[model samples]
Target: MERYVLTVTLNAAVDVAYTVPGFSPGGIHVAAAVRRVAGGKGNNVARVLARLGVRVAATGFAGGAAGRFIQDELRRAGVVPEYVEVAGESRTCYAFTDPETGVVTELRERGPELGPEDVARFKARYDRLLAGAELVTISGSVPPGVEPEIYRYLIERARSCQVRVVLDSSGQPLREALVARPYVVKPNRAELAGWAGRPLETEADVLEAARRMRTAGPEWVLVSLGADGALLVGPDGAGAWRAVPPQVAALNPVGSGDSAVAGLACGLVRGLGPEELLRQAVACGTANARTAGVADVDPAEVERLARRVRVEPV
Candidate 1:
């Protein structure tokens, strides 16, 4: 049996991206280009992992025509889709990008609600997948009708199987999952600040907040700072490092964090050290930002960017 990474996106979506030259509110404009793919935080992570030659399987609730599209897209991308079908229709999220201003505006719909039956079916599938999974990534929001404690339950199950989990979420779900002590937790600067209930105004502030989160159970805390890069707090808060990328023009910043999570999972499975891990993670993020589509990174670009990433102990 091949070992693989398992990614869960409970509220999976068909992501649609449109490029408009001068996108402005309240005006009808023609799009220069359009792209659609399977998305949601975990799905993006799965896609990136597959691009990097990692065997990855994606699971969660998928329904309706949109859901079928997502499955087909993932299969075409070399990611195995094992989503549990639900009754409700999956959502379609839209992102409008203005190339002239380098701005992206997004509108996301709350996807199909999952009932107790749906959750039960998913858990059964998840448990079977965990058997072959080297790592698990749980990302994105909890859909309606599912309890926020869902993440906690999932983490506990993964832990029971002795599988390391990489969690990426915010708000109530994040708070609940932290108690389970995931192997890695990736939060953006704003998400960390929200959890800390205080403004993280400086590097020291961010570091302190990340350390505080470590006490909750995670072995590693990674806080992503757009442009400035990411901060990594090691196990037991023994060491902290900041990985900064060389500046590059960003075409789209959406899903960059998911790409970073993919990189982190890859590094962990490869047994990379702290510095190299951060370097690869930051490079994946930076490479994602340079692409017009979400989580679409060139392997050569990722390798090139990794060499330029400066990982400094903080």
Candidate 2:
């Protein structure tokens, strides 16, 4: 079997998006467009990875009609689905976009709860998948009945297999996984601030917070700054770089972060230098923002934007 990048989305969902022109509270408005697809942070990353010509597989829990939709969608997107079906139905998350105001309101549902058996089944499947995985990416929230320590266990297993892991999550799961020392941790500004227990107001503040996070366990801390671009702090703490992407008229910023994660994974697999890696990550993110669909980006656009990205040592 060929080694491929593995993406884990524990609480996978069917993402529904509605374009409502004059979206307001307590008002009747006809949606201009409605789109639904398989979505979770990891699934979004998988979609972008496939689009980038990477061999990728997605695993998580899925059930009922929504789960079927998710599996079919992944197949359509050129990603192999390796989900474990549960007794409960998978969730469907809704996002309402107001084109007039350029604002998006989201309503997300907590997916099905997992039992001990379900967890055991998933672990067994994950163990088998890890054998043929060059790298692993775990993203998004866990469903009810699953402990935060699950991420830690997964990271440990992947490490035991000598596979690098890129973790994109928040709260307790993020905190727990850090102890496993994943290769990379990608957190948005707000997520980093939450982990830091303080507000990061300036560039220096953000950099300092990222350094502190590095001490926890992760080899590299990539702090995503919406609009301003991203900051990458290396393992040694001495090497740091800031990537500023070329400005574009952003149509939707929903899954830009996941696209960035996909870019980082691709860079890692390709053995890119730090500067080039940051450029690719920022370019993918910026390109995703140009489209309304989540993680939908053109490779040509990404290449063009990568050339314009400015990366400098900090």
Candidate 3:
């Protein structure tokens, strides 16, 4: 039996995207097109991994009509859904895109609050799902009433099951989960700066911060720099590589980080080397940026971008 990669999104949402001729805040603008899809960081990652031909299962707390839409869309995208039902309606996120200027503005909702019963139920479901999972990726923020330590508990559980865990989160949850030592961690420049409690002003500063983080837990740390590309560091600072992606006109940068996380997770599961992994990760992110919508990347585009990516060891 093929072992599936499990993705966890504690706060799931229905993502609605609208394309307009141009965006003018506080002014009326007619939309050229509208689309709705399943969204959440992990859900986006699962979609990209599925596109890369990996078997994936997405699990999290969801409810109401929006939740149903999320599950249906995940199924349509070839990602198996195994969500736990909650009492409240799931949240909705709105993304407004300007095709002319390639600017996207998003209005995201804080998810519904979860109670003790909701947390307990989701934990029970997650434990059972771990039985068949080879790797687990936990992403996004936890809803209200959930402790920041929730990720720590889940990381410990995944370790007990002998499954690799990849974490992509920030702030308090990230601070707590670092103690559990996940296999990999993906944080953008801003997040890393927040964790370090100081602005990372240079490439050297970012690399140093990534090295400091590696000592706290995760075997690998990947720091994304948006158009500037990303920097990767391995366990104990034994290896380091930086990948600069090819410049392309970006359509929607909303879920590009999730796409990068998907690529890094894919490379890890396939046992790709550090350089190769960074290449693939950058390629996927670039492909995502070059296209519209979340995880709507083209495979051939990814392959072509991969060759154009410039990776250098630090």
User: lDDT of each structure?
Assistant: 0.95, 0.95, 0.92
- Model 1 C-alpha lDDT versus the unseen true structure: 0.95
| Residue ranges of candidate 1 with Cα displaced over 4 Å | none
lDDT of 3: 0.92
Clashing pairs in 1: none
lDDT of model 2 at position 250: 90
Give all candidate RMSDs, comma-separated: 0.8, 0.8, 1.1
Off by over 4 Å in 3: none
- Model 2 Cα lDDT, one tens digit per residue, 1-314: 67899999999999998989999989998999998989999999999999999999999999999999999999999999999999989999999989888899999999898899999999999999999999999999989989999999999999999999999999999999999999999999999999999999999999999999998999998998978999999978459999999889998888999999999999999999888889999999999999988889899999999999999999
**TM-scores for all predictions:** 0.99, 0.99, 0.97
lDDT at 33, model 1: 97
What's the true lDDT of residue 310 in model 1?
Answer: 97
lDDT of 3 at 116: 94
RMSD of 2: 0.8
**Cα lDDT of model 3 by residue, 205-294, tens digit:** 999999999889999999999999999999864799999998898887878999999998888889899999999999999999988778
